[model samples]
Target chain A: MEKVTININGADYSAEVEPRLLLVHFIRENANLTGTHVGCDTTSCGACTILLDGKPVKSCTMFAVQANGKHLTTVEGLAQNGKLSPVQEGFHEKHGLQCGFCTPGMMLTSVAFLKKNPNPTEGEIRWAISGNLCRCTGYVNIVEAVKYAAEKMKESNQ
Target chain B: MIPAQFEYAAPVSIPDALALLRSNPDAKILSGGQSLIPLIKFRLAQPALLVDINNIGGLDYIRAQDGWLKIGALVREADLEDSALVRRSYPLLYDTTLSVADPLVRNRATLAGNLAHADPANDHPATMLAYRAEVVATGVNISRVIPIDDFFRGLFATSLAPDELLTEVRVPMPKPRSGGAYLKMERKVGDFATAGVAVQLNLDAAGKIEQIGIGLTNVGLQALRAKRSEDALRGALPDAKGIERAARLAQEDCDPASDLRGSVEYKRNLVRVLTMRAIEKAIERAKGM
Candidate 1:
C-alpha cells in the first residue's frame, strides 16, 4: 500500500491505499464523494469525469497513486456553500436530464468547457461534451443547458 | 474495476526512472496513463511495478528549435490542439491531434505514449511516418535517436529496450511550399480508423512535386510508408492521372485484415479514395490558396 494525499473540492483526503486503486474508486469509495460515477470502466464513457489540476480527465482511467499530490474537483464541488453553480442551475432550468446517471459528469465537463470557451455555438457545445454519453434526453436539452450556462456565466462576469 | 496488485514508484528524474526500469525489467513506465491504465484494468497487461514519470520535470514542452519541431514526451495532445503555433505552422500535426480519442482523453494522452504504444490503429505513428520524425530513447547513461522507420517492430511492440524511455520526438521542419494533411474514416468519434492516410509533400517553383511521403494507418501490421506512391510522384506535377496512379499504389501497398471495420477490398478502396482526397487537399495547402 502507498500513502497518498489528494485535495478534492478544497478538502485534503489522505489514505493508505493499494497501488492499483483507480482514482474514481478513491473518490467514490475512499473519500466518500459518490458524485463521480463509473459508467464505463474502459474509459469509453465520460461518466467518471473530474477536474484534476484544473484540467478534465477520466478518473477511472487513472490510478489513485497517479493523483497523489494533485488538486481535483468532483461534481460535488460545483456549487458554493448551498447555492447551485451556473451549470447546475442551467440544468435545472433547462430540464437537461432524465435518469441523472450522466448528470454529474456532464455538468463537470460543461463547467470546465465554459472556462475555455465562454460562448460556444451549438455544434461546439455538442463537440465539447462528446465524451460524456447520455442514454436519456437524446442530448438536445443538454446542449440547451450548456448554452444557458454560458449566458449566465457571461452575465455574471460583466 | 480494480487493477491487479502492483508496486508503484514515482520517479522525479529521468535517471531515477531509468534506474527503476533497469532494476525491474517487468515494470512499465506510466506516462499520462491514458492507454496503459485501460490495459491494466482489462488484465491485458499486469506489470509487477509501474514507474510513474509524471513527477519528473522538464519534459512537458512543444517548441521549435534549430529548424525542427521538438515535442517532449510529457506534452499532452491537448497542448498541441490548443497551440496557436501548431495551428499556424503544422496543419498536418494539428489535424492528427484533433482526431485523437476525444477532448477529455487528449488532456492526458501524450504524443510519446501514443507512439511508444506502437498500436497500428493509433494516429501519431502515421503522422510521424509522413513527417519522417525521429524519437530520442534514453536509458541509463545511454541515449540514441531512432528514425520513425525503424521504430515499430510489430503490433503492440517497439524497438525500445526495456530500460529505455522515449523522452522526445523531433520532426524536421517542412520546406517552403509544402503542406500535409491526415484523413481518417472511423465508425464514430474516438474510434480507431477503419483506414487512414497521411500525406506530406513539397512543390518546386514550377509546382512539380519536389518531395513526398505517404503513410497508411490500420491497414497493415504496422504503419506502412507508401514508398511506391511517393516514388511515382517525385519531380512530377500532380495532375489527376498522376494523383490517381499514386493513390492506386497506396491501395496496393497496404495489407489490411478483414474485420468488423471492413473487408480487405473495402479498406483498400477506402485507402485509394482517402489518398486522392488528402493529396488534393495537401496540394491546395501547398499552394497557400
Candidate 2:
C-alpha cells in the first residue's frame, strides 16, 4: 500500500490505498465524494471525467497514487456557496438530461471545454463533448446547455 | 474494474526510473495510463510492478533544435494538439493528434506512450513513420535512438527491451516545399481507425515528385510503410492515373483481418481510397495549393 494525499474540491485528503486503486474509486470511496459516476470503466465512456489540475481527464484511467499532490475537481466541486455553477444552472435551465446517467461527466466536460472555447458553435459544442456519451436525450438539449453556460459565463465575466 | 495487485514506484529522476526497471524486469512503465490502465482492468496485462514517471521534471516539453522537433515522452497528446509550433511546422502531426481519441483522453495520453504501446490501430505510429521520426530510448547504462521504421515489430510489441524506457521522439523538420496529410476512416469520434493513411511528399522545381513517404495504419500486424507505392510516385508526375496505380499497390501491400470495423476487403478498399486522397492533398500542399 502507498500513502497519497490529493486535493479534491479544493480540500486535501490523505489515505493509504493499494497501488491498484483507481482515481475514480479513490474519489468515490476514500474522499467520499461520489458525484463522479463510472459508466464504462474502460476509457471509452467519459462518465468518470474530472479536472486534474484544471484539465479534464478520465478518472477511471488513472491510479490513485499517480494523483498524489495534484489538484482535482469533480462534479461535487462545480458549485460554490450553496449555489449551482453556471454549467449546472445551464443544464437545469435547458433540460440537458433525461435519464441523467451521463450528466455529471457531460457537465464537467462542457465546463472545461467552455473555458478553453468560450464561444462554440453547435458543431463545435457537439465535438467538444463527443467523448461523453448520452444514450438518452439525443444531445439536443445538452448542446444548448453548453451554449447557455458559455453565454452565462461570458456575461458574468463582462 | 480494479487492476490486480502491484507495487508502485514514482521515480523523480531518469536514472532512478532506469534502475527500478533494471531491478524489476516484469515492471511496466506508466506514462499516462490512458492505455495501460484499461488493459490492466481487463486483465490483459498484469505487471508485478509499475514505475510511474509522471513526477520526473524536464520530460514534458516540445522543443525544436538541429532541424528536428523533439517531443519529450511525458508530453500529453492534448499539448501537441494545442501547440502553435506543431501547427505551424508540422501540420500533419497537429491534425493527426486531433483525431486521437477525444479531448478527455488526449488530456492524459502521451505521444511516446502511444508509440511504445504499439497498437497497430493507433494513429501516432503511422504519423511518426511518415515524418521519419526517431524514438529515444534509455536503459540501465545505455541510451540509443531507434528509427520509427524499426521500432514496431508486431502487435503490441516494440523493439524496446524490458529494461528500456522510451524517453522522447525526434522528428526531422520537413524540407521547404514539402507537404503532408493524414487521413483516417473511423466509425465515429474517439474510435480507432478502420483504415488510416499518412503521406508526406515534396515536389521538385519542375513539379515532379522528388521525395515521398507513405504510412498505413490498422491494416496489418503493425503500421507499415508503403515502399512500393512511394517508389512508384517518386520521380513521376502525381497525376490521377499514376496516383491510382500507386494506391492499388498500397492496397495490395496491406494484410487486414476482418473485424467489427470492416471486412478484409473493405479495409483494403479504404486503404486504396484514403491513400489516393492523401496523396492528392499532400501534392496540393506541396505545390502551395
Candidate 3:
C-alpha cells in the first residue's frame, strides 16, 4: 500500500490505498465523496469524469497513486455553501437528464472544458462532451445545458 | 473495478525513473493510463509495479532540428493536435491522430505510448512507417535508434527492452514536393480501424512520381509497408491512371485478417478504396508543399 496525499476539491486528503486503487474508488470510498459515478471499467465511457489539475479526465482510468499531490475538482465540490453552481442550474433548467446517473460527471467535465475554451459553439460543445456519454438525454439537451452554462459563466465573469 | 495489488511510484526526473525501472523490470510504465488501466481491470496484465513517468520533465516537446522532426516521447496527442510543426509540415500525422479515440482520450494519451504499445489496429504505426520515423530509446547507460518497422515486433508486442524507454521519435524530412496522408474506415468515431492506408507521394522536377511508399494496418499481424504498391507507383504519372493502378497494387499487397471489423476479403476491398482516397489526398498535400 502507498500512502498518498491528494488535494481534491480544495481539500487536502491523505489515505493509504492500494497502488492499484483507481482515483474514482479513492474519491468514492476513501474520501466518501460518491458524487463521481463509475459507469464503465474501461476508458470507453467517461461517466467517471473529474478535473485533474484543472483538466477533465476519467478518474477511473487513473490510479489513485498517480493523483498524489494533484489538485482535483469533482462534481460534489462544484457549488458554494448553500448555493448551486450555474452548471448544476443549467441541467435543472434544461431538463438535461432523465436517469441522472451520468449527471455529476457530465457537469464537472463541462466546467473545465468551458474554462479552457470559453464561448464555444454548439458543435464545439458537442465535441467537448463527446467523452462523457449520456444515454438518457441523448445529448440534445445536454449540449444545450452546456450552452446555458456558458452564458451564465460569461455573465458571472462580466 | 480495482486492479491487482502492485507497487506504484512516480519519479520526478529521468534518473529517478530509470532507477525505478531498473529495480523493477517486471513493472509497466504508466503513460496516459487509458490503455494500461483498462488492461489491468480486465486482469490481462499483472505487472508487479507501475513506474509512473508523468512527472518526469523534459520529455514533452516537438521541434524541427537538424533536418529532422524531433518529437519527445512524452508528447501527448493533444499536444500533437496543437503542434504548429505537425500542422505545417506533417498533416498526415495530424489527420491520423485526430481520428484516434476521442478528444478526451487524445488529451491524456501520449504519442509514444501508442507507438510503443504496438497495437495492430493503431493508426499511427502506418503513418510512421510511410514517414520513415525512428524511435530513440535510452537504457541504463546507452541510447539506440530503431527504425519504425523494426521496432514493432508483433501484435501488442515491441522490440523495446524492459529497462529501456522510448525517448524521441525522429521523422526525417522528405525531399521537396513530397507529401503523405492516412485514410481509414471505422464503424464509429472512436472504433479501431477496419483497414487503414498511409501513403507517401514524392514528385520529381517534372511532377511525376519519383518515389512512393505505402504502409497498411489492420491487414495482418502488424502494419506492413506496401512495397508492391510503392514499386508500381514509382516513375508513374501523379494523375488518374497512376493512382488507379497503384490502388489496385495496394490491394494485391495486403494479407488481411478476419475479425469483427471485416472478413479478409472485405478488408482487401477497403484497402483498395482507402488507398485511392489516401493517395489522392497525399498528392494534393504534396503538391501544395
Candidate 4:
C-alpha cells in the first residue's frame, strides 16, 4: 500500500491506498467526493474530469499516488458556502443538462477552459468540451451554459 | 475496469529512475498516464512495476538552443500547443499537437510518452519524422540520441531499451524560406486519425523546391516517410501537376489495414488528398503566402 496526501476542495486528506488505485476512485471512495462521475474508464470520455493543480485532467487516467501533494478540484469544490459557482449557476440558468450525468465533468472542464479562454466563441466552446460526451441534451444548451458562465465570470471580475 | 496489482516507485532523479528500471526488468515507465493507465485498465499491459518520473523537475521545458528546438520529456501536449514559441517558431508542431486527443487529454499527455508509446495512429511520429527530430535517451551506462526515422521499430515498439528513459526531443530549426504543416482526417472529435500527412518544404530563391520531407500516419505499421514523394518534389517546381504526381507516390507508399476508420482504399485516398493539401499549404507558406 502507498500513502498519499492530496488537497481536494482546499482540504488536505491522506489515505493509504494500493499503487493501482486511480485518482477518480480515490476521490470518490477515499475522499468521499462523489461529484466526479466515472462514465467511461477509458480516457475517451471526460466524465471523470477534475482539476489537478488547476488544469483539467481525467482522474481515471491518473493514479492517486501521482497526485500526492497536489491540489485537486472536483465538481464538489466549485461551490462555496452553499452558493453555486458561476459555471454551476450558468448550467442552472441555461438548462445545460437533462439526465445530468455529464454535468459535473462538463462544468469542471468548462471551469478550466474558461479560465484560459474567458470569452470563447460557440465553436471554441464546442471544441473545448469535445472530450466530454452528453447523450441527453445534444450539447446545444451546454455550449450556451459555458457562454453564460463566461459572461458571469467576466462580470464578477469587473 | 480495474488494473492488476502492481508495485510503484516515484523517482525524483534520472539516475534513480534508471536504477529502478535496471532492478525491475518488467517495469514500465509512466510519464503522463494518459495512454498507459487506459491500457492497464483494459488489461492489455500488465507490468509488475511502474516507475513514475513526474517528480523530476527539470524535464518540462520548451526552448530553442544549439540550432534545435528542445522539448523536455515531461512537457505536456497542451503546453506545446499553447506555447507562443512553438506557434511562432514551429507552427507545424503546434498544429499537430492541437490535433492530439483533446484539450483535457492534452493537459496530461507528454510528447515523449506519446512517441515512446508509438501508436501508429498518433500524430507526433509522422510530424517528428517530417521535422527530422531526434529522441534523447539516457540510461545508467549510456546516453544516446536516436533519430525519429530509426526510433519506431513497429507497432507500439521503439528503439528504447527497458533500462533507458527518453529525456528530450530535439527538432532542428526550420531553414529560411521553409514552412511545414500537418493535416489529419479523423472520424470524429478526439478520435485517432484515419489518415494524416506532415509535409515540410524549403524553396530556393528561384521558386523551386530545395528540400522536402513527407510523412504519413495511420496507414502503416509505423509512421512511414514518403521518400518517393519527397524525391519527386525535390528541385521540382511547386505546381498542380507535380503535386498530383507526388501525392500518388505517397498513396503508393502506405500499407493501411481496414478498420473502423475506413477501408484500405479509403485511407489511401485520404492520404493522397491530405498529402496534396499539406504540400500546397506548405509551399504557399514557404513563399510567405
Candidate 5:
C-alpha cells in the first residue's frame, strides 16, 4: 500500500492505499466520509461529485493517489459548525430530493456551480445540473434549490 | 470500482514524464482519467504503471506564435472554454469543448488526451480535422508531427506508438475571412457523438468561398474528412444552395455503421443535418467576425 496525504474539508487526512483505489472509495472507506455516493463506474453520472482543488470532479473517475497532496472537499464537509451550507439549506427548503441518494453530489455540484455563476438563469441552471440526474423531482425543485442557494449566497455578502 | 493496481508517478516536466513512461513497460499516460479509469475498472487495461502528466509544468497554455496556435497537451477542455485565446481565435474549439459532456468533465478532460484516445465517436477529432491541426508526439528519441487525417487510423486507435505521448497540437490560424463551427448529435448529455460535423470556410474578398474544409465523425471507424463536400464547396459561397449541396456531399462521403448508440441510416442523416447546420453557422459567424 502506498501512503498518500490529502487535505479534506480543511483537515489534513492520510491513508495507505493501493494504487487501484478510487477516490470515492478512499473518501468513504479510509477517511470515513460516506456522504459521497457512487452510482456508476463510468463518470456519466454526477453521484460521486466532490471538489478536488476546488474544482468539482467525479470521485469515481479519479484514483486516490492522483489526488495526493491536493485539497479535497467532500459532501460530509459542506456544513460549518453543524449548520447546513447554503446549498444544503437551499436543497432542504426547496425539497430538491426524494430518496436522497443523489443529494450529496447535487449539493457539491451546486456549490461549484454557484461559484462559477452566482446568478444562473433558468437555462443555465438546467444545464449546470444536467450532469446530475434526479429521477425523483424531475429537476424542478433542484433548479429552484440552486436558485435559492445563489440568492442566499449573494445576500450573505451584503 | 477499484482499478487494478499500478505504480503512480506524477512528473512535472515533459522530459521527466517521458523518462517515467520509458522506464515502465505498459505504463499508461494518464491526463484527466476520464476514459482511462473506466477502462481500468472494467479490466480492459491492466497497465503496470500510470504516469500522470497533469502536473507537467508549462504545458497547460494556449499560445499563438508564428501564425500557428500552440495548445499544450495538458490544456483541459475547461481551460479551452475559459481561454480567451481559444474563445476569440478558435471559437469552434471553445464551442465544441463547452458542448462536451458538461462542465465537470470539461474541467478535467484534456484536449491531448481526447485526441490521443482516438475514439471514433469523439467530437474533437472532427474539429481538429477541420482546423487541419498537427498532432505532435514524443517518445524515446522520437518526435513526429502527424496531420489530423493520419493521426487516427481505426476505431479507438491512433498512430501514436505505445511509447509515444502526445505533446502538443499545432493549429495554423485561419485566414482573416475564414470561419468555422462544429455540431454534434448525441443521444444523451454524456454519450459519445452519434454523428458530428465540423465545417470551415474561407471566403475571398468578394465574399465568395475560396476554400472549404469539412470533417465528419461517428460515421466510420475514424473521423473522416469530407473530401466530396470540400470539392463541392470550392470557389462557392456557403450560401443556402451551396450549403445544401455540401450537406448531401457530406452524407455521401460517410459510411456510418449501425451500433447501439444509433442506426446507420440515422447517423448518416445526422451527418447531413449537422453538416448543413455547421456550414450555415460557420458562414454566418464568418460574416460577423
Candidate 6:
C-alpha cells in the first residue's frame, strides 16, 4: 500500500491506498464523496468525470496513486455555502434529468465547459457534452440546462 | 473495476526514470493513463511496476523550432487542440488532434502515448505518417531518432525498446503553398475510426503537385504510408484524373480485415473516397482558398 494525499473539493483527503485503487473508488469510499459515479468504469463513459487541476478527466480510468498531490473538483464542489451552483440550479429549473444517474458527471463537465467557452452555441454545447452520455431526457433538456447555466454564470461574472 | 495490484514509482527526472526502466523490465511508463489504465483495469496488461512520469518537468511542450514542430511526450491531445500555432499552421495535425476520442479523454491523452501505443485505429499515426514525422527515443545516456516509417512494428507494437522512452516527436514545418488534411469516419462520437485517410501535399507555382504523402488508417496491420499513391501524384497536375488514379492506388495498397466496423470492401472503398476528398481539400487549402 502507498500513502496518497489528494485535494478534493478543497479538502485534503489523505489515505493509505493500494496501487490498484482507482480515483473514483478513492473519492467514493475513502473520502465518502459519492457524488462522482462510476458507470462504465472504462474510458468510454464519462460518468466519473471530475476536474483535475482545472481540466475535466474521467476518474475511473486513473489510479489514486497517480493523483497524489493533485487538486480535484468533484460534483460535491459545485455549490457554494449550501447554495446551489448555477449549473445545479439550471438542471433543476430546466428539468435536465430523468434518471439522474448522469447528473453529477454532466454538471461537472458543463461547469468546466462553461468556464472555458462562456457563450457556446447549441452545436458547441452538444459537442462539449458528447463525452458524457445521458440515456434519459434525450439530451435536449440537458443542453437547455447548460445554456441556462452559461447565462447565469455570465450574469454573475462567475 | 480495480486493476491488478502493482508497485509504483514517480521519477522526478529522465535519468531516474530510465534507470528504473532498465532495472525493471516488467515496468510500464504511465503518462496521462487514459489508455494504459483502461488496459490495466481489463487485466489485458498487468505490469509488475508502473513508472509514473508525470512528476518530471519540461516535457509537456508544443513548439516550433529549427524548422520542425516539436511535440514533447507529455503534451496532451487537448494542448494540440488549444494551440493557435497548430490551428493556423498545421491543419493536418489540427484535424487529427481534434479527431481523437473526445474532449474529456483528450484532456489527459498525450500524442506521444497515442503513437507509442501504435493502435492502427488511433488517429495520430496516419497524420504522422503523412507528415513523415520522427520520434526521439532516449535511453540511459543515449538518444536516437526513429522516423515514423520505422516506428510501428505490428498490431499494438512499436520500435521503442523496453529501456528507452519516447521523448519528443518532430514534424517538418509546412512549407509555403503546402497544406494537408485528415479525414476520418466513425460510427459515433468517441469511437475509433471506421476508416481514415491523411493527405499532405505541396503545389508548385504552375499548379502541379510538387510532392505528396498519403496515409491509410485501420486498413492494414498497421498505419500504412501509401507510397504508390504518393508517387502517382508527385509532379502531376491537381486534377480529377490524377487524384482518382492516386486514390485507386491507395485502395489497392491497404489490407483491412472485416469486423464490426465494416466489411473489408467497405473500408477500402471508404479509403478511396476519403483520399479523393482529402486531396481536393488539401489542394484548395494550399491555394489559400
Name the candidate that leads on DockQ: 2
Q: Candidate 1, clashing residue pairs?
A: none
User: Please, what is the whole-model Cα lDDT of each candidate in the order they appear?
Assistant: 0.93, 0.92, 0.85, 0.93, 0.85, 0.93
Clashes of each: 0, 0, 0, 0, 0, 0
- Tell me how each candidate scores on DockQ against the true complex: 0.84, 0.90, 0.70, 0.89, 0.78, 0.89
CA shift at A123, candidate 1, in angstroms? 1.5
Kindly list the per-residue Cα lDDT of model 1 for residues A1-158, writing each as its tens digit. 89999999999999999999999999999999999999988888899999999888999999899999899999899999999999999999999999999999899999999999998999999999988889999999999999999999999999
Pitting candidate 2 against candidate 3, the one with the higher DockQ is 2
TM-score winner, 1 or 5: 1
RMSD of each: 0.8, 1.0, 1.9, 0.9, 1.5, 1.0
Q: Please give, for residues A76-95, the per-residue lDDT of candidate 6 as tens digits.
A: 99899999999999999999
For B105-200, candidate 5 gives per-residue lDDT tens digits of: 887888888889888777788889988889888877869999887898888889888778899998889787778898887778888888888887
Model 4 residue runs over 4 Å out of place are none
Instruction: Quote the positional error of residue B9 for candidate 2 in Å.
Output: 0.4
Tens digits of lDDT, candidate 4, A1-59:
98999999999999999999999999999999999999978888899999999999999
Clashing pairs in 6: none
Instruction: Give the TM-score of each candidate.
Output: 0.99, 0.98, 0.95, 0.99, 0.97, 0.99
Q: What DockQ would you assign to candidate 2?
A: 0.90
- For candidate 2, the chain B TM-score comes to 0.98
1 or 5, greater by lDDT:
1
Q: Per-chain TM-score of chain B, candidate 5?
A: 0.95
* Residue-level lDDT tens digits of model 5 in A77-126: 89899999999999999998999988898888889889989989999988
User: Docking category for candidate 1?
Assistant: high
What residue runs in model 6 are displaced by over 4 Å at the alpha carbon? none
Q: Kindly list the per-residue Cα lDDT of model 3 for residues A15-99, writing each as its tens digit.
A: 9878888899999989999989889768877888888888788888888888998999898889999688888989989988999
Clashing pairs in 4: none
Write the number of the candidate with greater TM-score, choosing between 3 and 6: 6
